[model samples]
Target: MVSRRAFLRGLFGSFLAALAMLIGLPLSYKWRKRMSPTRHSMPETRSGAIPLPYPRIRGEMSLEEAIAYRRSIRDYLDEPITLEELAQVLWAAQGVTETRYGFRAAPSAGATYPLEVYVVVAPRGVVLPSHDFLEPGSYRYVPQSHSLLIVRQGDLQEPLYRAALEQEWVLNAPVNIVIAAVYERTTRRYGERGIRYVHMEVGHVGQNIYLQATALGLATVAVGAFVDEEVQRIIGAGPHVHPLYIMPLAKPLEPYRVSKEELIGYIESHRKERR
Candidate 1:
């Protein structure tokens, strides 16, 4: 007879296997080349490794502290940052904490996990995963193992700037973190109505990054202005996945401030139950 712990472990493993099989492959790139104008564009794949250094880490913050501190910032200093700082930012945004369960720094719909993280880094501030500088390009971020896969090489600032509809914030920052999602990743499970889950997951990840930036003493601005097709192209994304938000990261220009009334109103609005 197996020990109780072993028996439970077996049961759980079997259950997950059965669940996966029953679900089938919910969403598998049917819209492979569906591009939209103005979306982020990128090359197909990277020929080399991306520079991802060991992340710099800090102790966890209390929920209150994280909330009280979180805010959106746009202005930054034209300063150089460390490879360690970049690592810490990515880890805080979506790095895997525990490999056993394949859990991520962000939540997903049904753990289908459709969100992809990418980065546009400058040379002065940080050295990346493999110390590979493909020269001003976008890269795919592998969070589970903390590595980057090159997608596109060469300066993409102009295209990204255009795709973002000439959002100066995208060009002003030292790095840009783009988050995209395969909508069907969640929708296929619960049907098209589940698209809400995809957006919800995006928001969760967005907030996670925001909190991390706050704690790290950095500035970040989330932008939603872009032609979806161009963005997908800038990142060299496949057809099914599409851009959702762009977060430009940099040093802070000034401290964040908010009035008590504004804070109260924000909380109250969020707290109200959906009709």
Candidate 2:
């Protein structure tokens, strides 16, 4: 039995969700698909260390070439990564497509963007893959052009590693992307039902990162073990930007691991109907 007031509230919530979706979905899609009218602007922050803006090189490798390079390296070589490689990886993860319709590296729910990317760049300055270790610090990703924005600069590895349930990989990876989810972006439209859509969108972004890393001859693995609040606090997202997944990436050895049978199984499951 439902009270009149509760019934009306439910009806109102549904109506509001439908109306918002009707209008917001297209706008969100256009927003994701379009590029910023202005050139890339790194968000202003006085963090002392200036984040280097690397020119992103696109279409450098064929899909097969990238697939061949896919791997997850816990141990990197004795050499640091080049700026160009970093830029390329970030761009592939979420770079703007055509300066219109903000089509980013990953898909979204109704174009109502809900994900924010951040980097935990090792070393306060540039992290060298070589012997001279760089300092440990946290950074936010500027998606407009995939630039790194320094957030908390210090030896956060211990805390971060602990937050991630003592996963040694957290301390070892050269760079980690903390993928945060802002639920309301979609919930405002689809209401509670939007929860499912938001989760799907996050997976899309994570896969985008994996594929891009694989393409760039880098190693990466998806992580979801860290304390959500701790990650959010470190990355400096509001209550809305809830952390969902963390992906740490590094350079790997040649020859990626692939399971053709597993891939086929996945393709078949969704071929008829996702349900």
Evaluate all candidate structures by whole-model CA lDDT and list the values in order. Answer: 0.68, 0.63
Give lDDT: candidate 1, residue 87.
69
Question: Which residues of candidate 1, in runs, are more than 4 Å off?
Answer: 1-47, 55-57, 60-63, 123-134, 257-275
Query: Which 10 successive residues of model 2 have the least lDDT summed?
Result: 39-48
1-275 in candidate 1: lDDT tens per residue? Answer: 34566445544644674474334322211122232223223222232344466665554665566677677787778864555666677887778775555567887655666688887765443433444322456766777557665566556766888899998767777678899987765675568767888888889888888878777777787888899999899887878878999888888888575567888998888889543
For residues 17-119, what per-residue lDDT tens digits would candidate 2 score against the true structure?
Answer: 4584456545533542253343222332332223445545566666765664555556554344554556666666667664544556676555666677777
Give the residue spans of candidate 2 off by over 4 A: 1-60, 68-73, 124-136, 253-275
Which has the greatest TM-score?
1
State every prediction's TM-score relative to the real structure.
Answer: 0.71, 0.67
- Give per-residue lDDT, candidate 2, residue 129: 36
Error of 1 at 237 (Å): 1.2
